[model samples]
Target: MGNAYYKLNKIAESIYYYEKALLLAPNDQEIKTNLSYAQNMTWTL
Candidate 1:
């Protein structure tokens, strides 16, 4: 779900979910992807 958001360029949504997910699993792959993608976009998502 969150990964899909990041993949589709919805950096904000991805970041939101990734942050929440981080509470449970900080090393999540999808979260990493979202963070990286957001970083690349320079949106701080």
Candidate 2:
């Protein structure tokens, strides 16, 4: 779901979903990495 939002260029939504996912699996490296990507996107914007 997060990835879908990311691909759609919905950075806020992607970050929201990624944060939600992180709550469930805090140690998930992929989610962390993806969330980092989304955050970086925000910085670029």
**Highest-TM-score candidate:** 2
* C-alpha lDDT of all candidate models, in order: 0.73, 0.98
Measured by TM-score, how close is model 2 to the native structure? Answer: 0.95
Per-residue accuracy of model 2 over 3-35 as CA lDDT, tens digit each: 999999999999999999999999999999999
State how far residue 32 of model 1 sits from its true place (Å).
Answer: 4.4
Q: What is candidate 1's lDDT per residue for 1-45, written digit by digit as tens?
A: 567787887777877777787778887886777667676775543
* Residue 33 miss distance in model 1 (angstroms): 6.0
The regions of model 2 sitting more than 4 angstroms off are none
